[model samples]
Target: MDEVAGAIADPVRREILVLLRDSRLSAGEIAGRFEISRPAVSRHLRVLRECGLVRDEVVGRQRFYLLDPAPLADLAGWLGALLRPSGWEHHLDALETEVHRTRRERRADRREENTA
Candidate 1:
């Protein structure tokens, strides 16, 4: 996970992953999409590859890169557990609403007592 975080920490690397998400692209093709040098793009690809976020294939002389979804799926699974609504959330919300309602009722009673 730390490796994945480090790989995605760079904006350029994140963009590279986005480019590779839908289609495989050669390094030259990726480098062309950015203003940065091909060497720079290669470095980003290396980080992504090392972290298992991307995979590369050498077809003839050209090296193609594509997104590897397994790591992202693992990330999603972790996040889903954290984000899924717990049954207690509804009860907590109801409790909060009841507390506010009780406060309002007390204030109204105090106002009526003062007037009387």
Candidate 2:
């Protein structure tokens, strides 16, 4: 998981993963999409490969890379859990609304008493 996190920490590597998400691309194809040098793209690809986020296959002398989302599942699940609202959230929101309503009612009562 650490390796996966580190691998995606780079913007270049993240872009590479996005490029490979829907379709496999040869090293040259992937490199061509970026303004950086082919070697630089290759280095990013190496990090992704090491992290199991991508898999490369040799076909007709061209190495093609594709996304392997299995490793990301754990990270995604963790993030989802963090983003999900806790059970207390609804209760807290309700309590806040009730407090505001009670304050408004008390202010109204005070106004009525003062008017009387």
Candidate 3:
């Protein structure tokens, strides 16, 4: 999971994943889409391949890469669990909101009292 997380932390790698999501592309084909050097893109592809985010196959002279989202399942579940709010969190948020509202009301009352 850590390796997958670190692999996708790079914007270039993430973009490569997006490109692969549609269809497999040869290394040269993928490199051509980027302004960076082919070697740089290859490095990013290597990272993705190592992390299991992508799988590559050799066909004749070209090596094609495609997305492999299986590793992302665990990461997605972990993120979902983290983002889910606990019951106490909801209560605490309501309490904090009420406290702020009370303070605002007291201030308004004080201003009115002073004017009167």
Candidate 4:
């Protein structure tokens, strides 16, 4: 779980996962989308592979990467268990909605005050 979290904590790795979610891609293809070097992208791929979030296959001379998704499922299950038992997630969601509403109301009030 720690490894999975660590792998996904990086924005670049998350984007990589998004890219691979739809289709498999070669290392060069993945690297092409970013400004980073091929080696840097390879390192991100390595971390994802280590965390079981991605898998690579050697086809011909190039390596292709695809999302495994099992580890993410496991993480989701773990988080669901933690959130459901305590009911904290429900409370958090409610609080978030309330905060958004309050912010919107404040903005409206300020606009009216300025117009007046």
What is each predicted model's overall lDDT from 0 to 1? 0.90, 0.92, 0.95, 0.93
Indicate the TM-score of model 4: 0.69
lDDT of 1 at 30: 96
| lDDT string, candidate 4, 1-116, tens digits | 87898899999999999999999999999999999998999999999999999999999998899999999887898888876735777899889999999999999999999999
Better-scoring candidate (TM-score), 1 or 3: 3
lDDT of 3 by residue, 4-24 (tens): 999999999999999999999
lDDT of 1 by residue, 29-66 (tens): 99999999989999999989988999999999999998
Instruction: Give the candidate order by descending lDDT.
Output: 3, 4, 2, 1
Residue-level lDDT tens digits of model 2 in 1-116: 77898898899999999999899999999999999999899889989998899999999888999999999988989889999778899789889999999999999999999999
Best by TM-score: 2
Candidate 2 vs candidate 3: the TM-score winner is 2
Q: Is candidate 2 or candidate 3 better by lDDT?
A: 3
Q: Where does model 4 exceed 4 Å of error? A: 85-116
Task: Compute the lDDT for candidate 3.
Answer: 0.95
lDDT score at residue 11, model 3, on the 0-100 scale: 92
lDDT of 4: 0.93
